[model samples]
Target: MNALTPQPSHLAMVPFVSVANMLKIVNRIGPAQMIAGIAAYLEDDFRRWEQFDKTPRIPAHSRDGVIELMPTSDGEIYGFKYVNGHPANMARGYQTVTAFGVLSRVENGYPVLLTEMTVLTALRTAATSALAAKHLAPQGATTMAMIGNGAQCEFQALAFQKVLGIDTVRLYDLDPAATAKAVRNLAGSGLTVVACASAEEAITGAQIITTCTADKQNATVLTDNMVGAGVHINGIGGDCPGKTELHRDILLRSDIFVEYAPQTRIEGEIQALDPDHPVTELWKVITGQAEGRRDARQITLFDSVGFAIEDFSALRYLRNQLSDPGEYIELDLLADPDDPRDLFGMVQRARP
Candidate 1:
């Protein structure tokens, strides 16, 4: 067979990590270690933020749900994630969010890796939140109030414990079953998990508050009076237009940090603020170009909207871990023909 021939060769196969393999990878690496590994990659990329091509995620909104494409590149590799958000799916016995992603070599524009990102997204989101908290949260803060106990609750709790040395997490959700589920999942995690009766009780002694509700509207999950001095609020649930968690007055009193200003202005907790309202970019804090946590009394807020570069970092990390042969599967994704230009010949040969 010639170089372009349709032969069973490794060149025509792409490495893919399915949901099962992804779970195995996480199990092998351990969830805390995986979160830390992804966080290290995220920190390295954010420090060299200027080297990346960044853009706001492109979204298509419908009455019931939304679909989005988040893409970014670092000159050598390009990555993008195809994700959907359908809050109604949970009631119908499905995950509210599901995703997959691709990593490609920029030179030849060939895909090098294809993997399920639903689990990876949860890992990266929690890692990114912990990374931000490391910079913005008060030093020696150990307790976190998780306002939403859905799919992301356990991940967030573990990430904080692993990255920020948090030992306790107070959980609260509108649905009591969610709190019960999180409590069960976190049983052996060595964390002091408490199911709170209300949001006020969740934040009683917690220094960090994470809001990750699945609602798609501007719900005042955390009001102004609830938040107090020296608390770092990680607002993750307010990730799209018309979706937010905190009250506007709380935003007015806090030093807001965000992934990207342009995107956060439209989709994050800062969306409640005026267009000219000032916010700090989280990358700058990591790079030491800007300040984080100016004082203990200052309320710090990370208006997280899940940026493309974070997904790019996750894809990059996954590609780096593919050296183990058994960690992934190969799929015949490319067509090869005896002649580079003879695409029709390859199709004809496959016909019985």
Candidate 2:
């Protein structure tokens, strides 16, 4: 450890992965492989869903966007993520979504890992989508229509390709440049990338359709008329109240699966339905407690409003990746004293 890096002898140092180091990790592992790795952890956690304490995310809503804290824990470990969604940020030359997260031991309440999650969140979100599709998408689904080609477009495309053997991604965005950007990024991804003129064109032969626009309203990115039978729709952009992508009729016709029912009922596409609208939690399907896809003709929708467990799994993956110490730098974020009661004295003694 560098001398300038905090090393309080009394405290357990937290390993922090900065944005640059996170990029290194991703570049080292490759995005598709990282998504697959995180998906494995997600599946592991979901299979043990009964062991976790779950709740809705706490959000602070503003006129421009929303910020939220998603938290969850098993008996042995705890984790949380600080995330925000601001649709206008893209126009302002900033990220529409940004986040950071931490994972800590339940026994001592000391964080073992702290990492920048903006990039990690993107990877995990893609992994979760792919995991859901692996269970719910049409069998042998080889093509996907990506309706919004923004920050998450290529990740979704690549994930579906990596996880579902999707060979073609048809891209469309209200802004044509977004589609062009996706086409550019996915050039060497080994999947067939086709830039389409419209949403209808994008879904031409797609068995799976993923709508991930960044608008912060009840925009009908996908109307009922557009969605065909037997198509698996993945809606990820409707992550807050009053914001949705798919039409209510589409949700009514599709067998909707969600991360957490309570949170999804408030912030997912299902929010457009009645309070008593029935849905299945994805964990049940992962754990074999509930059915995923009953037939090839069933329209399955993963109304992904992202849950805390996925973040916990991602943070856990990051923490476990510590076989390489250089992947993160240590930070003295906690104030532990030789004597538990001498926190102030410990601070005063570090005057140099």
Error of 1 at 124 (Å): 0.3
In model 1, the runs with Cα more than 4 Å from the true position are 1-6
Residues 1-352, model 2: lDDT tens digits: 5565435763657889999999999999999999999999999999999999999999999999999999899989999999999998989999999999999889989888899999999999999999999999999899999999999999898899999999999999999988988999999999999999999999999999999998988999888889888999999899999989988899889999999999999999998899898899999998889999998788999999999999999999878776677788889788878788987887776666
Q: Could you tell me every candidate's TM-score relative to the true structure?
A: 0.97, 0.97
Give the per-residue lDDT of model 1 (tens digit) for 246-274: 99999999999999899899889888889
Q: Cα lDDT for residue 83, model 2?
A: 97
TM-score of 2: 0.97
- Top candidate, metric lDDT: 1
The per-model lDDT (C-alpha) reads 0.93, 0.92
Pairs with backbone N, CA or C atoms under 3 Å apart (clashes), candidate 1: 4-337
- The RMSD (Cα, Å) of candidate 2 is 2.0
Q: After superposition, how far is residue 167 of candidate 1 from its true place, in Å?
A: 0.6
Off by over 4 Å in 2: 1-7
